[model samples]
Target: MKKKTFNVLLLSVLLSAFTIACTKDIDFNQIDDFEVTPVIESSLIFLDEPANQFLEDGVEISSVQDSVLVEIFKDAFIKEHLVKAEFVFETTNSINRGIELRIDFLTDSNIQLHSFSFAVEASSTNTPTIFNYTEVFENNTLESLFETGKLLFTLNLKPGPVINENTPGSIKLKSKGIFFLNIDNTL
Candidate 1:
């Protein structure tokens, strides 16, 4: 009985020492820095009287197919791994006419990455009706967006009729985007 008791006590001390030796401190130095890009904003106006209101530089209009392509940002994103992205689109309607808007994001190669659609209420009293939309992207999904290089915006407008032909209404769209980047030490 005495010998058995001694063996058990020795086994307990050895087991405790082995457990303490296996534990180590965790290191969190893998993340290097966080960077934020400046806000990018753009706007476009659509008029009924002029018919082709999107004829300015950086704006393209196709009357035959009723389409509009506007380059909102040219190489706007920096060369860093994107951690998060937030985009806000605000539409102000002063044209007494409702419109359906289709917004597309394209890569430098003109490949579309994503698209969104929204509707704007008509402004019958000349007061601007505003609508806001927000989107957030994170992690691996955001890294791919930065790899696309430059970003382009393609806008398609389907407008409703004017309340009064004498007093035609117009639409103006305002959009802004912000990016949060990270320089991962592992990268």
Candidate 2:
């Protein structure tokens, strides 16, 4: 009986102490000043083409073209919050021929918004040659990036040794895009 009475007394004291602790009133208006900056990284393209793909009917193709539809820019929320964008491309060439890569950002009507190009050196041996390129969009360029609806990639083969279906190497490309956004919540 005595132990049970002591436990009840201790519980009552702890509850009273917790109730007496003071807390300041929260200001809900502070939420209006909240802002957040977020960075998003996404894979944009990956191409691994064998040398044979560049040959058609025993003739070496001058260029290979590909395009991807970009739908993220269609979002109004993303457009309003986007502040900057960066695109990074890495190419590995094991073929014995130099290549030029051209990237174009286009609108829904097929109008070109932005374009850039970079060259990758030819590999002398079976060893691969690597090239890295980065394109940053800010200030005026950010607006052009937001208007992009499609991305076109063109790979132009440079004059070199003849490439046949028996060619021993391939060309690999990896690319990504980083987007920076600033959002503000105000009531």
Who wins the TM-score comparison? 2
Give the per-residue lDDT digits (tens) of candidate 2, residues 1-187: 9999999999999999999989899999988899999999999999999999998888989899999999898798987888988999999999999999999999989999999999999887958999999999988888888888999999999999989999888999999999999999931
Worst 10 residues of 2 by lDDT: 178-187
Q: Give the lowest summed-lDDT range of ten residues in model 1.
A: 58-67
Q: Which stretches of candidate 2 lie over 4 Å from their true place?
A: 1-19
Give every collision pair in model 1.
Answer: 95-169, 95-170
TM-score of each: 0.51, 0.86
Top lDDT prediction, candidate number: 2
lDDT of 1 by residue, 14-110 (tens): 9989988866666665345433344433333333332235343434342212233434322343444445677677777675556666655556666
User: How well does model 2 score by local distance difference test?
Assistant: 0.92
The true-versus-predicted C-alpha distance at residue 19 of model 1, in Å, is 47
Off by over 4 Å in 1: 1-80, 147-159, 162-166, 183-187
